[model samples]
Target: DTAVSQTPKYLVTQMGNDKSIKCEQNLGHDTMYWYKQDSKKFLKIMFSYNNKELIINETVPNRFSPKSPDKAHLNLHINSLELGDSAVYFCASSQASGGHYGYTFGSGTRLTVV
Candidate 1:
């Protein structure tokens, strides 16, 4: 079983359009997160959810939203996609209630805006 999976490994779209990417994990984890890796390779946390509750990271943009239906799934929705949104989105998960444990990330979903 795949521990974590993200769809549309690559996505190209025009600015002003809305798009979404799906993610799922089979690791029986209770927490999931969305991270953005910009061209410079800086990894930034967008949102984190544990048991469907929001744990927003202030560094992220308002246009980005993360939704988790359960512990095993987290999806990202981007509104009014902009050139600045051109980056790789990674879905990650870790054991619930732990901080020392590292997170497992998906290969990545590269979003290109034109």
Candidate 2:
């Protein structure tokens, strides 16, 4: 079974459109995160959810929203998509034990905005 899984592995849309990507994990982790990999391959944390509570990165725009229905699932929604938002989004899960436990990341969802 996959430790973490993300749906719609690829997304292509117009700049003004809205889209959402779903993610689920069977690892029974307490914390889940959404990360974005920019064109330059810089990875940045966009949002994090611990037990369904949200902790968003200050640098992320309001247009991006992350919702976790439970500790096992986290979904990302982007509204009024822009070209700058095009990037590979990754979903990851980690236990409360910190970095020593390491994290499992799902195959990323590549979004392209025209």
Candidate 3:
């Protein structure tokens, strides 16, 4: 099985709707990250947490929230979705000690806001 997995690989919803993407990692890592990739393939870090604690929250909109129920799972929820929210969201995990290597990534979730 994949070390990291994300459900709802593809999501299509209308504007002003709310949706969520779930992610889980069985790598026994301590850190997890949420990333977004735009049409031009520009990847941006949206949120990150270590040991289920919020670590880094880039300048993402308030509508985007990341929740970690435990060290092994992290989920992204978006409210009042807009067309600009269309993008590929990726989930990743790594060791918190080094915080720089051995990252296992999930097959990404493509979200489209129509």
Candidate 4:
């Protein structure tokens, strides 16, 4: 069983189109994060929400947004998609306790713009 799951493992859209990726975690974690992996395989943190509160918001474009309906879910929405947006988006959940952190990651959603 997967601890974290993301829908539509693959996404393809045209430029200027809008798209959304959904993520959910079955583990009992309070913090969830969104990460983007570019073609070169460099991972960048996009957003992190903890216990229904916005904790960490990285330097991402305004076109990218994170929406969380609850603690276990965080979705990524992108507007006016461009060719440069093509990459793999990952959703992960982590737990922080006593200076120790444990993370569970989803399979990731691959977005391609053309």
Better of 3 and 4 by lDDT: 3
Q: What digit string (tens of lDDT, one per residue) describes model 1 on residues 33-77?
A: 898899999998888988788876657777987878887889999
Tens digit of per-residue lDDT, candidate 3, span 1-114: 789999999999999999999999998999999999999999899999999999999999999999999999999999999999999999999987764586788999999999
Top-TM-score candidate index: 3
Cα lDDT of model 4 by residue, 1-114, tens digit:
789999989999999999999999989898999999998999899999997778899999999999999998999999999999999999999985544676688999999999
At residue 35, candidate 1 shows an lDDT of 89
Screening candidate 1 with a backbone cut-off below 3 angstroms (N, C-alpha, C), the clashing residue pairs are none
Predicted candidate 2 versus true structure: per-residue lDDT over 25-63, tens digit per residue = 998899999999998989888898898988656478889
Query: Which residue pairs of candidate 4 clash?
Result: none
Q: Please identify model 4 stretches exceeding 4 Å from their true place.
A: none
* Candidate 4: C-alpha lDDT: 0.92
User: How should the candidates be ordered by lDDT, best one leading?
Assistant: 3, 4, 2, 1
lDDT comparing candidate 2 with the true structure: 0.91
- Candidate 1 has a TM-score of 0.94
RMSD of each: 1.2, 1.2, 0.9, 1.1
Q: C-alpha displacement of 92 in model 3, angstroms?
A: 0.4
The deviation in Å at residue 86 for candidate 4 is 0.5
Q: Which rank order by TM-score, best down to worst?
A: 3, 4, 2, 1
Model 1 CA lDDT for position 114: 100
Identify the leading candidate in terms of lDDT.
3
